[model samples]
Target chain A: MIRTAVIVFPGSNCDRDMKVAMEAVTGSPVAMVWHGDAEVPACDVMVLPGGFSYGDYLRCGAMAAKSPIMRDVIAKAKAGTPLLGVCNGFQVLLETGLLPGALMRNASLKFICRDVHMTCDNNETFFTNCYRKGEVVTIPIAHHDGNYFASDDDVARLEGDGRVVFRYSDAVGNATPEANPNGSVANIAGISDATGRIVGMMPHPERLFEKALGGTDGRRVFESALFSVTEATT
Target chain B: MKAHIKITLKPGVLDPQGKAIEHALGSLGFNGVDEVRQGKFIEVELAEMDEASARAAVEQMCEKLLANTVIENYAYELVA
Candidate 1:
């Protein structure tokens, strides 16, 4: 069985939703690890769900990044535990230094909540193994500070290293200015760590994991990642 | 001891909030506002007595938490 745990911080409105998504697909009980804890239970995959952690005060993810549980998350992340951060969770990853770059306010200076197309840039990572290269998928994004920014040189390095896993794209999978919803640098919508064990993105893949949710495109991400975790044990 | 910290976005970074503030000022009839870059100012009171020591402590805080070096820079002054 693929063990799963979801980290829950204060004001994490989506923690239950993330748990529902993981359990629905994985058929495994997911633990809700509180931010006050020092460590998460043993699990194959750990998810950092979206929400206003610590009310997003002191900079979106700043305060939460200093939480006690995050200290353990950071240590294990370095030891190679698979982690997936979604939306505000992505902000936490950046603040924890587990991922590169920073998320600033959207160029339009507004909170955007809508479905956007994303092209799978690299399918070799654990989280995206089921995706075909360059395939376009629909996912929902809702955030005020989703604009991804990094130094030009750092952007180049990420591209060169193939850590970039997804890019905002049009319906036809073409990366265009109009298709970029958040003005992220290089149209990057998602990326993985150099080890490919950690993935962070602003979109809520767990939000559309079922047909009733209007799209099943997001199911494969959870399924693909869980499969890898289960496969590793056997 | 009181420490004043100013946090600003690094050069060349896009500041949408600052831009929005600038536009709002323009609409309110504030002229000659070529640009307006918004930042944060923080005043911290510490029990430390030495001015130099307090400034150094606050500077460390800036580097560690008050600022995100990836996109922002921080400057601090210690007041007696």
Candidate 2:
């Protein structure tokens, strides 16, 4: 059985939800690693779930990014372990330098809470392989600081390298100004690093995985990543 | 030694809060307030005796934790 670990800081409110979601799909126990711990422990995939880590002090994920366990997380990331960071987790990954770009205050300066449509930009990566290219998926986004910022050089590099995985779009999957919920550059809802092993995104895919809640479009993110890893290993 | 650090977003970066403040000031009939930008002020006390070393330490802190240099710039002054 493969293991997945979910890192939990003091103020993390989504760790349990993520754990339940992963367990339901993977049929294995997911470890909830504490922020104060020095080691992340060995896991196939490590998750940094969304929440107000460190009570959103200084910055959304700043203090939590410097927490003790991050040293291990960074090491593992460098050694090629796949990582998925959601919402606040995305901010933390940016702060940790595992992923590029900073998530600033939303352009509206107000907390956005609603479902947003996103399109799969690249289905070749381990995380999005389950969805066809340009597939539209509905995911809930809840945050005040989901605006992504990056230097022009890096943006060009990311685009050229095919690292942008998801972009906000309309119901028909058209990228437009009105479709951009938080003013992210190019309507990027999620991005993968150059290696495509790590992903950070602002949407809450775990929150609406079951159709009973609203939609099951979010399930393929985990399923596809699983397919990629298990197939590669075999 | 005491270090006072100020962190501000780069000029090109959008400051929504600052913009809101500017709008509020305009509504209050304040004249000639062309632009307003906001930043953070952080004060830290350290026991380093040497000024050069204190400045170096604070600069390192700014790079590592005090400020995110990617979008924000930070400057520190040593006091007393």
Candidate 3:
């Protein structure tokens, strides 16, 4: 059985969604870990769900990144545990230095909440193995600071390493300027660490996992992680 | 001691809010505006009495939490 842990920070509104989605997919109870805890339970996957953590003080995820639980999360991620950070969780990952780059205010300077098309740039990672590379999927994004920025060299390196997991794209899979939702560098919507075990993305997969909610496109993300973990263990 | 901190986005990093403010000024008939880059100002009260220690602490704070060095540059001044 695949076990999952969902870190819950104060003001994190999407923790419940993560818990529900993981349970629904894995058929196992997920542990809801408080941000104050120093250690996380043994689990196959860890998820940092979306929300206004620590009221998004100082910066979007600056305050929460320093939480006690993050130290353990960092250690676990470094040890090859699958870690997925969505939305505000992505901000926390960047602030914690687990992921390179910074999320700045959107070019439009507006809180955008809508469905956007993104092409799966790489599907070999633990978090995206279920997706076919270059497949276009629609996911909902709701944030004001989802514009991803990195140094020119870093962007080139990420692209070269095939670590750019997803890119904003049109319905037909063309990554056009008009398809860019938040002015992210090179139309990047999500990225992974060099090892591909740690992934951070601005889109919330848990929010769109069920067809009743909207669509099932996001379910494959969790399925992919679970499949990867199960494959590694077996 | 108080540490006055100024955090500004690094040169070449896009600042959408600053650009919006610049456009607003243009609409208000203010001419000759070159560009606008927005930043943050923070005042932190330090319990340390020694000037050197306070300065060091403030610098660490800027590096660790107050400012994200990835896209921002921070400068600070200590005042009695």
Candidate 4:
């Protein structure tokens, strides 16, 4: 069984959702880790769920990134544990310097909450192995600061390194300007680190992991992580 | 001692909030505004008596938490 841990911030609304998804996919009990806790339990995967941490004070994820739990989380991630960050969680990853780039306010200057189509840009990564490159999937994004930004050099390096895991795209898989819901640079919806073990994305896979919730498109993400861990263990 | 800090988005970064404010100003009959950019101002009360130490601490704070250097630039002045 794949052991999973979900880091719960003070304002995290999606922690339960992530726990439910992991349990459903991995058939294992998921650990709920408080942000104030100093140590993280041993687990195959760690997730930072979506929410307005620290009430979005100072900046999104800025305060939360400095929480006590993050010190260990950052260390574990650097030590090569699989880490996934979604929505505000992504912001935390950026603030922690685990992921390159910053999530600026939406170019439209509005909180966008809706389903968006994204094409899987890299299927070789542990987080994306369940997806086929160029496959378009529907996922919901709800945030005000989901516009990903990096310096020109950093953006170029990310593209060159095949770290861009998902790009906002149309139903037919064309990454057009109109298809970009948050005006993210290069229509990016998700990216991975150099190791491909850490991923930060603006969409909520936990929100749509089950068919009863709406669609099963998001299940593959969890399944992908489970598969990667299982393969490593076996 | 007090430290006054200003954080602004680096040039070339899209500032939709600032742009919206500019547009609102134009609609309100304010004309000839070339552009508008937005930033944040923060004041910190420091207990450090030494100016050099205070400056270093504030710089560290800005680099670590007060500002995200990825897309923002920070400037500060110390008032003793």
- Model 4, B2-76: lDDT tens digits are 999999999999999999999999999999985799999999999857988998999999999999999999999
Q: Candidate 4, A113: how far from true, in Å? A: 1.0
Expressed as tens digits, the lDDT of each residue in A143-195 for candidate 2 is: 99999989888788888998989999999999999999998988988999878
Give per-model CA RMSD. Answer: 1.1, 1.0, 0.9, 0.8
lDDT of each: 0.89, 0.89, 0.93, 0.93
For residues A75-108, write the lDDT of model 1, one tens digit per residue. 8888888999999999999998899999999999
Error of model 1, residue A85, in angstroms? 0.5
Note the DockQ of each predicted structure: 0.82, 0.79, 0.94, 0.96
Clashing pairs in 4: none
Q: How does chain A of candidate 3 score by TM-score against the true chain A?
A: 0.99
lDDT of 1: 0.89
Q: Assign candidate 4 its CAPRI class.
A: high
Candidate 1 falls in which docking quality class? high
List the pairs of residues colliding in candidate 2.
Answer: none
lDDT of 2 at B19: 92
Q: Quote each prediction's TM-score.
A: 0.98, 0.98, 0.98, 0.99
Q: After superposition, how far is residue A234 of candidate 3 from its true place, in Å?
A: 1.4
Report the C-alpha lDDT of model 2 over B1-80, residue by residue, as the tens digit.
79999999998888888999999999999977876999999999999579988988999999998788779999889899
Ranking the candidates on TM-score from highest down gives 4, 3, 2, 1
The native-contact fractions of the candidates, in order shown, are: 0.73, 0.53, 0.93, 1.00
